[model samples]
Target: MTSAAPHLSILDKPFVLDLFAGPGGLDVAGHALDIPSLGIEWDKSACLTRYEAGLETLHADVSAVRRDAFESLPPEINVLAGGPPCQTYSVAGKGAGRKALAEVKRYIERLMAGDSDEEIDKDLKNLSDPRTALVLEPLRYAIRATRSPNRDYRPYDIIVLEQVREVEELWKHYAKVLEETGLPDGTKYKVIVDVLDTETYGVPQTRSRAVLIARREGLGEPSLPAPTHRAYEAKEWNRRRDLALAQVHQSTLDEETAPEPEARQERGDDLQPWTSMGEVLVTPVGTHPGRDTPFLVRSNYGSSSDPGRRGVRSDQQPAFTVTGKISRFVVFQHLDESIVYEGARFSMNEAGMLQTFPPDYPWSGTAQAQQVGNAVPPLFGAHLLSAALGLPTLAPEALRKPWQPATEEQRAKLRSHGCGAADDCTARCPRPE
Candidate 1:
């Protein structure tokens, strides 16, 4: 959890490939720090984000790239960063997750093959032979397949794999692949990390996520940045608890096991102390989750419904993870708070400010809800990245102003950018059919 790298530094201003970069959260952080990064995402909204920021936006499937193609990227991508899709691994998906697990296996297999565009190309390596899958896990064989490139590329100095849950078996397979690739067994261990509170870094939101730093043999271990904010003195505090709940997953869950549906009307009226939806939402009351707007996650803590929609009380604490899968829908509730905003309500940008995004940052999208929901809070990204790389965070002059510093009026103006200036707490969100 609190991973102490053998010792690492991004003083070199590493190049990074943000695989599955949701709206450039990780990519922007690296860029702001003067690190060159390319974001690979399949979503159009996310790609637009990359384009607007003047960063390279590669529209491709990460698992589809050839290993040689990776070489085409920066020589020492100092960090290979990405958080693979975790929807399949979520407990909420229940027994229906078999396909997702299978996908993870296939994705890793393709990655082992050198992750190239020639996924089904001529002369594909049969590395993931049926014989190899068994040794790796249910799908270990996938790692041996060597990917060919469309343009030709190679590997980076280290690969940082991010994910909501640990997926121990996946790491096991990774270690096995490293051995096969000529790296020793011990060097194959993945360095998992926990995210610090973004608020400490000046982002109004309290987002936390897991980071994995992996290195090849002889590289010593990859380094992680030290926390710049003084939120907690115990550097190790976040590390251990951040390991996440995958270790204790139900392994079996269903609608029967789901938290009993709360009474919407009752919750809407007398939401308990520390249970108000506005607090976690961090906006003026009455302008969220409806009218084509997405929910805002003030913290990772909240029902697995509309993450940004419902808010927690002033003191209940954050929920474990965020992402569309496990998060609750906004038709349910919003975090508790009553800060006023534009149109007499706050906007996603305002909410994102709460979640942390650079003020000058531009998000191009008609779907504000989906865009904000999927983003990796820039502040969230900056916190972990700067700490892991043992670097300092950017000064305000070099980036957009902090979100909370904005007056209630400034926040409302930002909210209006993506959505029409409209606030309707009563509108059903996530479009319950």
Candidate 2:
């Protein structure tokens, strides 16, 4: 399933270069937007999944790839996006928080002290701590790309970085360096680094991530995209009313086939409420039909449910954040008004779908569930690129509709903004054939 070599000529226009590309989620979204892209990754299985999906890829460790090697890329590569592995900064991880932070600080101090790349890399390698330093690789590539004289010191016009919420402080530090760096034209990038809730952007799951967006001044101010869905407020719910079993799904779910449901019912302010776990899991095949309706049963890896943890998922509410260990998520069928459970974990496909990957997407890899859980939802990726490119984003239906390649008109509009170009070429350089 390795993709054919990409048309090198396509690089004549603006394109995306994704570092640490896991399973090509960002590249998929970029392709759907008609923007050609390439991903640099090191994981064998994740790379296999990317190739199976027909995504162009480079199976190389991103840290080892020299930025100078990218000189051949068109100068119109205004967008540089990446999501470095976040295990070290994840709240759930075992990395010593203070020690990791100190290590990062020491690394930064070394860089500021003009330590050689060889020396810094040697130290990092000797530490045997991959998570602590990988988070900073994106910034390394950015600095290399912008500071390389061989490329005339060209800079990415737009940069987007994402990681776990715990890394917001580190991102803020990176923002300072980015803000101080200037393009050849002496224009500085406007940078904003903040923590954003994925559900507010219409992701079905309630995941919060640290996001950094920067614009090479004049494109517009650096800003996070406004939320497209209603925010989840647990306190706003009246448990007696919101959690009542009688207040189940308005749309009838099929028992046998469990086909995809219709459009979402609108909530307050004419916006669709957060997508519910029931909406995502109830209808896909392999879901067990409970007595009359399906309800969620949350439990750890144990066979018996814990009263403190086991809870029912209301069809009307969005799911809690989906984690890497999806098998831990057990669903129960209410039999004769009693909760009866067998091991019914969300299938790999179901997990990917919940992450907003296309339903029929051919997901490959040994760690399928982990890949799906770690990926940025393709829908959210599309929105992010849309925001970065200053293009009108898709409707919420992006979750259900198959992605269509961008059209000539769309390319024209993107070029009009001087995206990926040395100078504004709105009138010159017609759409590539």
| lDDT for predicted candidate 1 compared with the true structure | 0.44
Against the true structure, whose lDDT is highest? 2
CA deviation > 4 Å runs, candidate 2? 1-13, 67-76, 109-115, 125-128, 147-150, 181-187, 237-270, 283-293, 299-312, 401-433
Model 2, residue 96: what's the lDDT?
Answer: 51
Candidates' RMSD to native? 14.3, 11.1
lDDT (Cα, tens digit) per residue for candidate 2, span 97-196: 4357767866765564456778887788755466678876766666667666656787677788888888888778777755664433344677888788
Candidate 2 CA-lDDT value: 0.64
Candidate no. 1 TM-score? 0.54
TM-score for candidate 2, residues paired by index = 0.76
